[model samples]
Target: MELRPWALLLSLLLLPSLALAAGKCERLVITGSPDAPPLLWRDPQDPTHLIGATADVLQQVAKDLGVKIDLLYGGTRSLALDEVRSGRMDILADAPLNLGELDNLDYIHPALVQTDYLVWTRKDSTLAYATAGDLQGLKGAVSERARLTPAFDTFATQHLNLQRLPTLTPVFQKLLLGEVDYVLAGRYSGMALAQTLGMSNDLIAHDTPIDQPGLYLAISHNSACNDPWLRGQLAKKMTELAGSGVAQAALQRNLERWKAQLQQPVGTQTK
Candidate 1:
């Protein structure tokens, strides 16, 4: 049969769609921060599973896109990232956008959510934290592994007196016990932890978040399915999710879930 001009034009119009369909990944393997509660974390009942905000958002996205995903507890944050970098995992459900990972990953932006670090202090402390600079003279405690914005990091390094602790619970203790003036920790996670420790009533968070870094869905470049189609699709869907308020809803739900889990009996407290 002879190819007509109309048929040729139709095929041309459909070329991009065809290419996208061809490159589409139907099933994705994903991992993220196993310790980042309310956003992503290892399930208590099953140490091998991961859940929370990121999982909730991805589940909705997967359903909308007609795709399947296996979100697993891949271990430490470093190990989970390594798995994605090596292509053993197709995606990182919760990742901060960084220039360093650009070579190995495509970040889906209009980020999935933000990881907010809040400044917490004892209710009776005289310290007034209206800005990062306000804590200049006060001794503050922070998680040693916490990631701070470059500007805040530099400011803190030069102007503030800081105590780097291995964990925030210790940091919070120091603040409560009048050892440190303030402690920096995640908003929701800190709330959950403080509640768990029976210290929520003794502390309060500053209105402004110390650092609010947006977390994104990142696709590994090493994956067999890594392509323009996958990246574009995810980014587009993420924008929709953000605008539709679905992402915020998921975050709120996860926060409540985290709070509930923390209220569990002592022996059954979740990881």
Candidate 2:
């Protein structure tokens, strides 16, 4: 048998790709929002762990990829971002797409979810919210840590009179007290927290959403697990999950699960 020189060259060129595809990281440690439910939240009964759609979906991804995931509560959003950014945590699930993080993380594209940031007002308020301009004169509050589209960020900064509260609970509280005319947050997430705080009936989300931004899983470039093989596989799987409608279904299911859990008596909320 005669072998061509081009065949040898091609085989050598393909070797690195093959090796990369074969490389696997044994464990991936992840952290995310401690209180953002439907997508993720700290288990009320077990503060040490996180549970919800993001957790459940990642568990499935781990099974498919044959990797281990350690999803734990790493504290507040800033603290969780710090841990993953520093490489102490391997991944940040439900991470918002931001320019700052691009330097330190490899973002999985097409995102696991895209959230609708709604304009929430007291049910009795007369704020007519059809667009961003309608919010100009109104004093508003947004969750201090909320991440929004760059366009909205710019628009709000330039035109909207808004303050940042620690979280949605207080933002809504302020709205009800008239400290702010409106509060902005993800529609479903705001609803979950509203139900938990027993204020679901008191607030109304404007029919129009303020912004819809994609939320992703970001792997730290500083992590030992952030190799090309793992990143590629993770991205591939995420795209599949998104395309198959699995991610949306998980979100829908968890929305109901979160409401049910939040609605339960204190003694029965957890198992």
Q: Whose lDDT is greatest here?
A: 2
lDDT of candidate model 1 versus the reference = 0.84
Per-residue CA lDDT of model 1 for 115-143, tens digit only, reads: 67899988988787778878877888998
Off by over 4 Å in 2: 1-23, 267-271
Off by over 4 Å in 1: 1-24, 266-271
Quote each prediction's TM-score.
Answer: 0.86, 0.85
Each model's lDDT comes to 0.84, 0.87
Worst 10 contiguous positions by lDDT, candidate 1: 144-153
Cα-based lDDT at residue 113, candidate 2: 80
